[model samples]
Target: MEPVTTGLIYAAAMAAIATARPKWEPNRGNERQYVLRPADISPLSDFGIADAAVYPVSAAQFPSGVDRIVSELNGYGKFGGDWNGEGALAPTAESVKEAIDFIRAFPAGLALPSPTISVGGEIGFYWSSAAGYVDLQIESLGHASLYIRNRKTGQDRFDDDIDWRTVGRQWYQEKLSILQDPLQIAA
Candidate 1:
């Protein structure tokens, strides 16, 4: 074979190998782990509920509460209640424990269903203080914000879209069973 032809073949082979065996670097920030922050009442309250004592609150209350909880827990600075933003709310250790407690202890009279926590990704699940028996699950993947609506309607639906990055797919899969039952995990 001609020298130039041999060089071209070698280059083509290298290009093929590079494309076939792509290297994936670990996320330096390691965004998969859940971060917790101090509990705040203002945003929680303003998110729309006058009192959590009520069995069923409006859906409007959930976003604000979720934002506040995420902020208090993650300490990613202020979230501005923008669902599409990349920022997350990490709860303090104590607050995380408290949140787990509250969800587990949620009154039976309220008839709230157990929550499924989707960890290690842009999608997160949490109970709303505004609605005693209701939970808010937010999913943001830098494309759009998807809210899983579990109230008002009898079916779960995607309400909207927001932009964010998703991480920790493995954590979510492993913790699926545990997240389904806070009481069982707590016990």
Candidate 2:
């Protein structure tokens, strides 16, 4: 085959593969794919706050949650009126980046699930699990308000000002126990 023809065939094959499959991820269900990681970009001018209660299924997934939070950072100025709608706040670039850094800095020794990222008017960024959640409110560079809550036990605690790095995984280990499976709860 001519060189040009061979190149065309390879290009077509690659496109076909991309269309048929997304990258795979483990520790997640087989359905997992490279849907997250490297946040997807959209026109911030068009970005409007949705009913945050129903978080996107994509944002609920692994690293995808990280992507969603990062992408939404531009929403900071989207709300022309009071940015805080029913307690819905846009995330600041600093806080969003810090939240991500906190997740990355998490102790590898802990098997904590990836947190679903959410925003609040009062809070800057939030990382949550069925077990517990953390709130990060950005202050000056390298400083933030950190809050942790045990959902099931209703143990809520926070520091109005501190560094996220100061939090230890052992604290989360204790909070994780508070999360009981809903199925288990039903039984």
Candidate 3:
């Protein structure tokens, strides 16, 4: 299916889910979101589907930025040699999947990060705030680089060959806090 069609379908499904379940509580303390209670007869349970599971879909599960990332990834995935008209290489399927997985793991509450495709066929997620910015570039599935700068402290840090697989939500929560609240001190 075309990427736009797929995205539309996903959006329609999410809309249906939201309509069936029209309750959204604030994030409060924890980043997780609960459905409160499932509709006894929502559209999701139609078509004779028995025992339709209504799992809690956290913001992290399908962050608001996922659509842009997926769209860019699909477009980039179809690129061939010289896709950029400058002899740029196409991103491998592995790299695309890696990028998807990494973004899918983002914790809830952080603002939507802008996504971009590099001439090197790599995917990057960037976040910026009044105080600083965080750049996460995915070279492949388990390999990438992270650059963070704090304008308040004039400190910069970069790490190579990062294994995002093991980085938990707490780690993202801490780093993304810079974007969430620049005035707050890093704990």
Question: What's each prediction's TM-score?
Answer: 0.20, 0.38, 0.58
Question: Using lDDT as the measure, which candidate wins?
Answer: 3
Candidate with better lDDT, 1 vs 3: 3
Ranking by TM-score: 3, 2, 1
- Compared with the true structure, what per-residue lDDT tens digits does model 3 show for residues 65-137? 4555666777778889788899787888888888877766655445657777788877788988878899999
Top candidate by TM-score: 3
lDDT of model 3 at residue 9? Answer: 91
Model 3 regions more than 4 Å off: 1-64, 180-187
Candidate 1, 68-144: lDDT as tens digits: 44434344222223333554333234434434333333222222333343222222344342212233443322333
In candidate 2, what are the lDDT values of residues 1-187, reduced to their tens digit?
A: 9999999999988783423112322223324244332344333456553322222343235544334444454344344334545555554555556655664454554443433334453225555768667665656555666667887778788777666577675765554444445657589
Superposition error at 39 for model 1 (Å): 26
Clashing pairs in 3: none
